[model samples]
Target chain A: MALSVQRCWNVGELSSDALRVAVAVSIEMNRDATPVADSIRLVRHSGESELLARQAFDTARRAIIRCGVNGFDLPAEKYGQWREIEMTFDPSNMRIK
Target chain B: MVRFLTLLAALWLMALPVQAQNGPLRITIDEGVIEPLPFAVPDFVAESAAAQQMAQQIARVVAADLTGTGLFREIPQDAFISQITSFNSPVQFADWRAINAQALIAGAVSMEGDGRVSVKFRLYDVFAGQEMGAGLQFDGTEQGWRRIAHKVADAVYSRITGEAPYFDSRVVFVAESGPKGERQKRLAVMDYDGANVQYLTDSRSIVLAPRFSPSGDRILYTSYETGFPRIHVLDVASVGRRVLENQPGTMSFSPRFSPDGQTVIYSLTQGGNTDIYRMPIAGGAPQRLTSAPSIETAPSFSPDGSQIVFESDRSGNQQLYIMPASGGEPRRISFGPGRYGTPVWSPRGDLIAFTKQSKGRFHIGVMRTDGSEERLLTASFLDEGPTWAPNGRVIMFTRETQGAGGQSSLYSVDITGRNLKRVRTETGASDPSWSPLQN
Candidate 1:
C-alpha cells in the first residue's frame, strides 16, 4: 500500500518575519515553487485577501524551512521512503501535509 | 548544489586590528573570507566659515561609504591619535598605525568668494608611509556639496580597490509604496546611496525596471501609462519622456541600451508569444531578433554590443541563452536545476549576473560567460533583476518581502557574494539599474 505522511513543527526561535524571509528565500531558491498565491489558496479558507494569505502562508513556510535549515529529525530507518517530501501547511489547523 | 560561504568565517568578533603591512599594502578578497582594511577619515580642514560644516559632513559621508563596503572599516575619531589640521601636513604614519588605521584620507574644504565649494582629498597607505597619489580637488556649486563629497570618496575608493568608482553613480529604479493589493510604483532617480531622490513620474501609472543608458544621461523604463507595458525613454536632465513606438496589439518591455547608446534591445509580446527585438534609440522600426514558440525576454547587450544574453523557455524549462547581436542561431548557457531569468551581461564582459530559482528558493547569482563556475550570491524570497556596477565587482537588485506586509527594497551584493546590505531609501524601492560613472 502507498503511504503518505505529513508533519508539523513549531516556529522555533526565529520570528515569523525571519521565517517568512526564509520561506521566501526557499521559494526563490526553488524555481518550481508555485506562485505564492496558489500555495496560499490551498490552506487559506478564511475570507483573507491574497495579501494576507500570502503573508500567513509565508510565515508558516518560513518556520518550516528555518527549523529545517540546520537539519530536522526523521525516521532514519525509513529514510528512503521519505527522502523527498512536499506539503502545504495550514496555519489555521497548525497541520502540515 | 553549490553553497555560499558565510561571510567572514573563522574570524573572531573581538579580533584586534592589524596595522602593520607584512608586505604589499593590499587585501586580496577570497570567496567570502576578507579582512576589511582599517581606515581613517579625519574631518576635512575647513578653509572658510562657509566651508566648516561642509567639511565635517563630507568626511562623515566618505567614512560611511568606505565602511559600508565590508571591505574597509573606519576607525572612530576617538581612536584617532592625531588630527589633520592641514591637507599639506606631513603624515605621522606612526599615529595612524597606533590606531590600526592601515589607510588615511585627509582633505580640505574651502568656499570660493563666488559661492562655490571646493573639496580636495588624498588617500594614504599608512603602513607604506606614503600618499597613494597626488591630492585631488573638486569644485561645485555650494548647494551641491554632497556631490563634491561623493567625488572625493569615489577617488579614494578607486585608488584602494582598483575598481571604477560607483560612489559617484546614480541609480534609476521604481519607487514603491502602499498595500500589496494596490501598490504604487513611480520611476525615480537618486544617488547610488539613495539620497537626493527625485521622482520622475507621478504615481498615476505603474512603472517597472528603469534602466540607465551607458552615458548616464538618459533612462529607459517600462510604463503602463497606456494600460499596457511599453518602453519609454527620458532625458534625465529635463525629465521629459517619450514612449517608444509600439506595433499595434503588441506589448514591449524589459528594455536596455547598447554600449554605444544608439540602439535599444527589448522584448515584444504578441499573439501570446514574446520575442526579443532591437530598434534605434531615436525611434524607428524594430528589427525582430528572435522567432521562437517559447518566451524570450530580458535581452542585455555585451559591453561591445557583439552578443546578447537573454532568458528563454525554448527548453521545457526556462533557461539562459546567448546569441549574436544581429540575431541568428543561439547557444544555451544555463544547464542548472532551476530556471534563470534577467541575464545581464557585466560591463567588463567577463560574467553575467542573473536571478536563479532552484530547490524552492530564489537567488541572485553570477556565472562566467560560458556558464561554468556558477555562484549564488544571495538567497531570499524574491530577489531578482541584477544590474552590474560600473566596475562589475558589485550587483544591485530588487528584493521584495513575502506576504501582505511585504514590500520591495533595493539590495546590493558583491560579485564575490561576501557582503549583502540593504540600500537606504526613504521609500520602498525596486528594479535598480546602476548607471555608468558620471563624466
Candidate 2:
C-alpha cells in the first residue's frame, strides 16, 4: 500500500522537474524535506510503505543534489514507514552565496 | 359577654403563619462602603444519605471563596444563635441583626442515584426582613458539588453588590514544586479558590505565561519543548492542542487573544530583536506589528479591540505604552522612576493593571489609560504579571522571592488596596490568569 504524507514547506520556487528531482533525492537519501529559509521549517506527514518512502527519499535526494545544497543529508530508505512525519530544516550553516 | 369576644379574637389571630413584618425597601451605600453582610453557611442539609458528607465539604469551600473576596464575613456557627432546621423555617431577623449580620444564607442538598447532586440556596436581607433575591439551584456530579455551591454564591454576590462575581471562575497557572534550579513547572488549572486542580501540560519542557482565551475555553501559552520558544493553543475541554506557527528562528511568546479569539497577539524574537506579531489561530503568515530596537513583550488588547497595551524598553527603561492594533506609533504612558512593565488592560476598559518595579521592590499597580492616578496595590520582593478579575474589581498576580531558594506563589488584591490575601493552591503557583465566567 502507498503511504500518505502531509508536507509543510517554505516560500521557495520549485519547478515540476525540480519537484520530481527533489522527491527522487528524498527517496534515495531517505530524507523528508529541505529548508528553504531561516524563516520556515518544512514538515512532512507521510504514511508507511517501504517502497513509497524509498520513492520519496529518492526524489528529495536528487533535488538537493541538483540545487547544490551542501551538507544536505537524508535518512535511510529502510526507515520510511512512519505513520506521522515531522522534520525541521536549518539554514544557519548553509552556504547559499 | 366582653370576655367571650376577646377570647374569640385572640384565637382567630393565632391561625395566621408568622412572618417578620415587612419593612420599607432600604438599599443605600454610604460612601460606597456597605458593611460586609454577615452570612452563615452551616453544613448544608443533605436530603439523601449519599450526599451527606459531600454537601458539608462543598458548603465550606463555597463559603471560603466568598468570604475571601472581602465582601462578606462568615458568621461562625457558634454565634449563629439559631439552628436552621429547614429552609422553610422562619428567620428571626432581629436575632441576625443583633449579631450585626445583615444577610443570611440557607441551603439544602440532595444526591441522586445517578451520581448527581443538586444544591438549592436562598439569600435573605436580614435588616429588610425579606428575601433579597430569587432562590437558585445547580446540578452537577458529586465531585463538582463544590463548583455548584460557588455558582450559587456568585449569583448572590452579583445581585447584592451590582458587580459580576468571580468565585465561579478558574485560574490557569504554572504549578511548581521542587528546588529552585530543578523546579518542575507544569500547566495546571483549578477552581478560583484552588480546588479541583487538573494539570494540562506535563513537566517535559519549560512552559511560561499560560493565558486563557476571552471565551475561557482555550489556553495560549509558550513552551520550549522543541528546543525553541513556540506558542501552543490547547483546548481546555478535550486537552487537544496544536503548535502555532512553527517558524524557525522565530521565538514566539507572550500570547494574548484579541477580544475576539480570531487573532493571537504575541512576541516574536528574530535576529536577537523582539517585537509584537499577530497570527491567525489556523496558522498563516505572522504580520509584524512593532519594529523597535528594544524588547516589546506582554501585549494585551484593550477591551474594545481598538488598541493594545504592551511593555517596552524603547524609552531606555521598561515602561508601559499604548498603540493601535494596526501598525502605528506608540505613546508612552508611564513616567515612573524605576520601571513599569507587564501592562494588562482591564476588562472594564477604564484602567490598565501592571507590575511596577521600584527600589528593589516590585508592586502590582493600576493606572488610568492616560497614565493618571497610578495606584500601587501590593508591595513585595518580586511581583509581576497582574491579571484582572472579570469584573475588574480585583487582580491576581504572581509573587516571587529573590534568593537562592526563592519560591513563587499567587496572590490577589482589590484595586483599592484592600483585602490583600494569599490564594491557596495545591502547589506553588504563579502567573495566574483568571478566566471569564463560564457560559
**What is candidate 2's DockQ?**
0.00
**lDDT per residue as tens, model 2, A1-97:** 0100111121111111122222211122223422232211122324143333333332232222222223222223422422122222221222111
Candidate 1 - CAPRI tier?
A: incorrect
lDDT of 2 by residue, B1-439 (tens): 5764465345324422231234211111111112344567767777888878876887787678768877677888778777666777887866775665555777888988898888888877654456756888888887777678788878766655555667888999999988999888899999877888999989988889999999999999998888998999999999888899688877889999999988999999999999999988777888999998899999999999999999999889999999999859999999978899999999989889999999999999999999998989999999999999888888999998889889999999977677888888878888899999865
Candidate 1, superposed: residue stretches over 4 Å from native: A1-97, B1-33
Model 2 residue B15 lDDT score: 20
Per-candidate DockQ versus the true complex?
0.01, 0.00
> What's the C-alpha lDDT at position B76 in model 2?
85
The count of backbone overlaps in candidate 2 is 25
Model 1 Cα lDDT, one tens digit per residue, A1-97: 0000022223221111222221211121122211132221222223224433333343344334333433433334533433333333333332111
Q: After superposition, how far is residue B137 of candidate 2 from its true place, in Å?
A: 2.0
Every candidate's lDDT: 0.74, 0.71
Candidate 2 RMSD computed on C-alpha atoms after optimal superposition onto the true structure: 30.9
Worst ten in a row by lDDT for model 2 chain B: B24-33
